[model samples]
Target: MKPEDFQFMSTMLKQRSGLVLNEDKAYLLESRLMPVSRAHNIKGVEELIAEIRKTNNEALIVEVTEAMTTNESFFFRDIKPFDMFKDHVLPHVLEKCAAKKSLRIWCAAASNGQEPYSLAMILKEEAAKLAGWKIEIIGTDISRQVLKKAEQGLYSQFEVQRGLPITLLVKYFDKQDDQWQIKPEIRSMVQYKYYNLLDSLTALGHFDVVFCRNVLIYFDQPTKGKVLEEISKLMPDYGMLFLGGAETVLGVSDKFAPVAGQRGVYALTGK
Candidate 1:
């Protein structure tokens, strides 16, 4: 609530998660983190800030960071990337990796598991095409809360309806009272992990395609460029990167260049 409190939280988020919270976003402290305060038995934002300052509690700090960073994601979000994956990207990557009989994909900023699960459905549909190939999909997020939801593979009707066609819904998900759970076959195709883009990605192994969508928009330019480079490094020369429709790597970094005909797709410049 106080200017000093706002500045403290804004700096803390930027340092911990690369989140850029402008002064105008001070209201988000109350809107997003009040529940965190309530959970810790703090009275209000002012009291919460006071407690954080007084105690310097690491767990409490983590809780506040995770609470503030919880973002919303729906299945097949924005639609076009998944369509592109099904129509063009898969066919190309399949041909390119056919000799190896394997392909690896990473979905960064993969909230609540929808994006990777959507890809899993596509893989399920293309089982015949990938008959002997080994497929691996890893979904990563900063929030452990959403990762748990993702691991459970459950979704409400509203979530399933958004950008997810009725056919795929009926085919890949089964009704569970009021919610739908992804079939085991599809759910088994993906793995979820706690990862921060700021952390070293060496342990995850190289990926043939990386979907770091809609995430960079929250970072300042320096952080954005840093994350883009980190992602590009994990990609092999022939690997592809899919960013959000509104995001671009043109001025941010030279690790990648826009693909010839794809809107949000980029390929290593090999520079």
Candidate 2:
């Protein structure tokens, strides 16, 4: 890809999804967008760029942006965060909201449904403890294509093995041909939607716990701040926020602070 093409896509990505692609990542753009080129029947990235330049259709621009951002992810791709969710966050929320028997969890950048499905499995395992509780686990991403796959809850053997424990796999998934399909009950626990972080929060409602992990590392500072601010608005005063291992609320927003004894967990400091 040409340097100008990289810059153009980077600008478009930042504008469309708040993801900042640096110059060194020109190779990544080539790797990800090559499929977009082929899908659109273009010969190469250069041709794709020329075609993008020819269009004013907002839908066309959205397709280019979505094509660039469809990252590969699986159930509990990083184990520690889910561990934290089950051990620390779930326990806390369960105790605090016992009276209501209702809980809302959101996986903001859930790619391929793995994260939310993992949570569903955890809840299933603790069925006795959460008896009669109303659980709503919502998974949202910028890519409609990925969300559709997520909603399907089918995973290849290789895809299921990534960070998935063999015991839970056997208990929660059923074999369909060569692939594993998440059980209908577990699949129904999560609601999937196409959501761009660049957009407003009014339509997303609010959550008791929000998992916006691993996404901020790709954004510029201003975009990160804006996204975090929007996230803060969608959480309760005492809600929890989970970030990637490398991310934090420090210097990003004053709305949250790291939870004691927990690595990536943040307690709402909006108090």
Candidate 3:
């Protein structure tokens, strides 16, 4: 891609999804957008950009943004967070909301359904503890394609194998054709939606725990702070934000503070 073309694409991605793409990442645009070009019968990224530039088509622009955005995920992509939830977080939430006997969790970037389903398994195991309680797990992603797959709750051999233990896999999944399908009970626990973090989250209401992990690293500092601010609004004072182990809220926003002794968890410090 040319310098001007790269700049246009970068600007478009930032405006549309808050993803920062530098000149060095031109290759990323070329590689990810090639599939979009082929799908639209455009010759390549250059031709696709030229056509979108000429027409200013909204649908085409969205398609390009979705294509460029990374959708990589796996079952319990990081192990420690889930462990923390089961060991520490859940007890605190239970104590805090003992009267209502309800809990809500939002998996902000629940690509293809693994993270939410993993939560579902834990919830199932603790069903006795949460008897007659209302548990709502909402999984949101910007990609409609991934939302569909998440709702289906089917996974390839490789996908299920990643981070999934053999015992739980046998208990929760059954062989269907070539892929493994999560049982309907687990599938029904999660609600998947096509949600962009850049958009309003008020429609989803409040959450006790918001797992917005491994996602903000793609944004620049300003965008990172903006996204964190948006997430903080949907959480309670006790609500916890889970960023990637490498990510932090130190200089980003005053809405959260690192939970003492917890590596990746941040406690809400602002409304």
> TM-score of predicted model 2?
0.95
Candidate 1 error regions (>4 Å): none
Residue-level lDDT tens digits of model 2 in 94-198? 888888899999999888899899888988988889989999999999988788889999999999999899998988999999999999989999999888888
Query: What digit string (tens of lDDT, one per residue) describes model 1 on residues 1-271?
Result: 7889888889989988988899887888889888887887888888988888899998888888888885788888888888899998899888889899899999998899999999999898889998989999999998888899999999998999888899999898999999999999889999999999889888888999999998998899998888888888888788999999889997999999998888899999987
Clashes of 1: 0
What lDDT would each prediction earn against the true structure?
A: 0.89, 0.86, 0.90
User: Using alpha carbons, what is the TM-score of model 3?
Assistant: 0.97
lDDT of 1 at 49: 84
| Better TM-score candidate (2, 3) | 3
lDDT tens digits, residue span 1-271, model 3: 7888898989999999888898888899889989899999899999999998999999999889888888888887789889988888998998888889899999999988999999999999889899979999999998888889999999999999999999989999999999999999999999998899988888989999989887898889988888889888888777887888879999998889999877788898864
Clashes of each: 0, 0, 0
Q: Please tell me which model should have the higher lDDT, number 2 or number 3.
A: 3
